[model samples]
Target chain A: MTTAPRLTLPAVTVGDRLPDLPYDVTATTVVLGALASRDWRPMHHDKDFAVDRNGVRDIFLNTPNQAAWFERYLTDWTGPRGRLGRMTFRMKGSVFPGDTMVFTGTVDEVVSDDTGCGWIGVDVTLSVGGDLKTSCHARLALPTTDDDNPWSRSGDRWTP
Target chain B: MTDLSADIEALIGVEQYEEAGEFPVERGYVWSTCSAVENGNPLFWDDDVADALTGGPIAPPTMLSVWFRPHHWAPGRDRVALPLQIHFDLKEALGLPEAVMTENTIVFHDPVRPGDLLTTRQILRSVSPEKTTKLGTGRFWVIEVEYTNQAGALVGVESYTGFGYRRAGSEAGVAP
Candidate 1:
């Protein structure tokens, strides 16, 4: 299902903006994503509790849901050849139903790791209704050539 | 009741939770989660697609925290009656009980493949003094969770920050 053009290590630069991704949030997407993340926090699904008790507008998106959106943005752009190495994000605004979350990113830096993997740093922003929902940064590993595959290397050997 | 008087400041380096799931990374959970996130990457569902790349299906890295919940229904770490939220009694001690996660950071070390049982240890990294903000007067804290596999191989580390606040005018400690 990876339809995007596979981006190789040599193709990307430090100022490239990834393809903008748009996702519409509904009650189902919010609840399902929370459940899948094994999150049972009331505010993520219970509208009544979130509004009356928490004073929020409605049932808002949970951390994992936002996290998944960030992951999708990176992997979708990298295609199958790239792998996620690290991700960090800060949630500023709550995302509710009927909100359209737009994900955009710009490559911040590029470096070569010791293990022959190309490391790419991206500064990402998730905005909804002209408001910033989450600001994120991630380091992705890309294969340099057809044979420089990150998938083939396995067995839990990596560092921070 | 009186606000928690316990000296919560003394609990800076507590390991609040060490959690793990009973079963290994199963296909059912992996596929369901991918579907929920709308991640159409074949590496999550199709075996042939994954086998061609990473040798087999792998769990999404975003599910790292999902695999390490509070350990409510597992062995070794059965939901203990831990002191106040954030593991330092600070939330209760300050009369600010409501909490919301404000930020997160995850470092992926390796791919989590099927049949690999995961384990995690959460440590109370830091807790800042009470501060006044638009929401209310609250304290900010950080909890770091380290994940590992069945063979004790390091998997990932997640740092989650939360702000526990009490609305203004609701309590005396709240800011106007």
Candidate 2:
């Protein structure tokens, strides 16, 4: 397995761009994801149903799938010490099994909490073939010092 | 067919709550599901990689959806309704000839991590009887579910629009 890049809290700030992560949405992939999520929605698994009934040419990506992509993009940048506070996205189009989705984002703002921890806000987007499929804004909290890392200690409570 | 419409109406526009069983953040489950969906990332499976990047054990975004599985109508019932999967099967069983998912949306207010017990409340936002093609007749129903942790913090809200279709010329007296 490839070693993931070293992610540090202080190193990230406003204007940092998350690396583009690529994924292929396939029939087996969509079906398995839907089954794992227990969505049982036909457009996610049944190509015929999607095309014949919904006028979609192929199986489409589900809401959870899009949310996952957004999370992946942010986590790659923030590392573990960073805690996701909130994320909201609006899906604009359907992503099919054959479509390649690229997840990317940019840090838009940063703030300090009362506990002296760092909080960063980001704007994220998912695109296929140069068309924006989804866009989101997210907030995350990170520790200023390694010792202050929230996830470092046991029984540390996470707050939104 | 029972007129669940009234029951549905009473439930509609009014929020009804249900609590889900506790679920651990299982890295294996996340990896398997991501792989099945062709999402290849060491962060989902390799703790070392995830720890190196995030500083702790973390779940993928798709992991939030997985919680919906292993849930049954009754508490403690492990029977999998596999709602999305069953919709497909229901199409086949009813011989309705066709069915489709028109839209779906999920809003995340908080991150769902390991060791979190999720409580969900669902509200039938709306139901609209609609027109369809010759293969069958159908209706569109919108349901929104809010998921909160044991601490009563809202985690996420998932909204789904589902279509149920019946086979042409086969809809006189069949049970829904």
Candidate 3:
């Protein structure tokens, strides 16, 4: 399978928009993500437990599941070389089965730190039916040049 | 600090070290996770690609916490009603019936690879006094978990903030 080409620092600009990622949620989607994350909470897989115990409409996506989707969305745009430095997100609502989750993001800043690390700031949102579910702010490291690999930086050279 | 109750105040800055995950990271598990998320990042799927970027085939950075998630059931271990012990503790302490995570911040430090065994230490960062939110009236708390690989190298750190509240009309007013 092919992946997006590696992104270089100079290629990015503030206000650059990432391609929209849309996913159709289903019971299988929720359960699979939970299982993959090793989360065995019934509320993530059992509808009765979710509806009765949790008092939600149905089983919903777990924390790590949503984080996985956010990482997937960001990496899909930056390709493999764009290494994440930090990510912070606030959950506003739940994303349940049958909801169509859309991920939209825009570049907030681009900078080369004193250590020569290239950083890109992004603001992202996960929404369902135009209603917000989560808002995210992420910082990732990109290559300053074709030869520079952000992953190679460590210790004092790397600081998120 | 004055707003925090005595019980909640005592938990701040206390770190709890947890046992290692049951199994080491496995390629099969990693592959399944990638499939589940529909993530086609070659770093997670192709060793050659990953070697070029992250030094070797590495699990997705997002999967750092997945490595330390406790099993739902074991041969001798009792089944847990909740996934997180702190959540249970906070609920019991604050007397809140419902809880939800509001925010999370994670910093990635090291790549987690297949065959790596991971462990975690969690600390109670802070707790808020009773307050009203759209969800209801309750308290807010923040917990931070630090992940480490078998070699004792820090892999990542996650600060999770949650709200434990009672729905409207049920203990709805602010704390007395």
Candidate 4:
């Protein structure tokens, strides 16, 4: 098994763009997410119920799924060393099953506190076919050291 | 309608609340959810990766939401309905113009792996009535649902905001 490279802080910038992560929303996928989250709402899994009842084309993506997408997007950038401090998101549109969703984000801002911990703010968005499905702001705690080693110091804020 | 505040108080601050049924956590189900979120990472599907990170097979963060089923009410039993079906029948029951998922907050205490039996108990946090353009008067309810594993370990808590709306008299017949 190949281990992911340890991510370093101060590597990302305000203008840096996250890679576009693409995925297909399938019936099986939707049901699986609903089952795992224990969110057995019919609008997330039942096709007929979504169409006939909610007037939606298909089962929609739940909020937790959207948040996970953000987490994945950031983790891919920060690697294993970054820690997510907070995330706030708003679901603008419904993501029906079969809809291809793409997640993208940018480093909105960055700052360092008195303790030398790097605080990065990001504006992340999830889109389906060019339409915005969810948008959120996230704050991540990164290391201030330039050393490539993530474990150089103990009790770092990014450990957890 | 059933004294929402009172219903909420009875459910909150309780350690072990009863659930209607159990939903199995299958490997296929975990992969499916990860795929839907556009996450193709092998960590979620590959056993080798799972073993490296978690020291065992574990479910993804979003996977927990899919595994939760509503608390089913036996005919005469006292059970709080979650209105899970109302999301589908919005037009008939409330004539809701739009149902939007506004926000979500989740806290994870433990990892949910395969073979972990889970149960959920929901508590209504707050309900705010507001006005909308398409749907005149609407309500947004914040519900906090806590999930625990079979061993009585708190797995996570999911806070979801669901918005229900009704059509305005003037815009009721207007076609978009």
Question: Clash number for every model?
Answer: 0, 12, 0, 19
TM-score of chain B of 1: 0.75
Worst 10 residues of 1 chain B by lDDT: B81-90
Error of 2 at B149 (Å): 5.2
**What is the DockQ score, from 0 to 1, of model 3?**
0.68
Q: Please provide, for model 2 over B115-141, each residue's C-alpha lDDT reduced to its tens digit, 9 standing for 90 to 100.
A: 677777667676665447655686666
Q: Estimate candidate 3's alpha-carbon lDDT, on a 0 to 1 scale.
A: 0.86
lDDT of all predictions: 0.76, 0.64, 0.86, 0.64
Poorest 10 consecutive residues by lDDT, candidate 3 chain B? B76-85
- The reply for model 3, stretches above 4 Å from the true place, is A1-5, B1-7, B79-83, B166-176
* For candidate 2, the TM-score of chain A alone relative to the native chain A: 0.85
Residues A42-129, candidate 1: write the lDDT tens digits: 8888999999988988898887777877887788788776778889898888889889988999999887767666788999999997
Which candidate should be chosen as best, given DockQ against the real structure? 3
Q: Model 1, residue B143: displacement in angstroms?
A: 1.7
Report the poorest 10 consecutive residues by lDDT, candidate 2 chain B.
B81-90
Quote the lDDT for A131 in model 1.
Answer: 92
Candidate 1 is graded, for docking, as: medium
| i-RMS for every candidate | 2.7, 5.0, 1.9, 4.6
> Tens-digit lDDT track for model 1 on B91-164?
55566756777777898887788889898777777777777788888778888878899889777888878888
Poorest stretch of ten by lDDT in candidate 1 chain A: A151-160
Q: Which stretches of candidate 2 lie over 4 Å from their true place?
A: A1-5, A152-159, B1-15, B21-28, B36-58, B69-117, B123-176
Cα lDDT tens digits for candidate 2, A16-60: 887787887677767776666656668888889999988989988
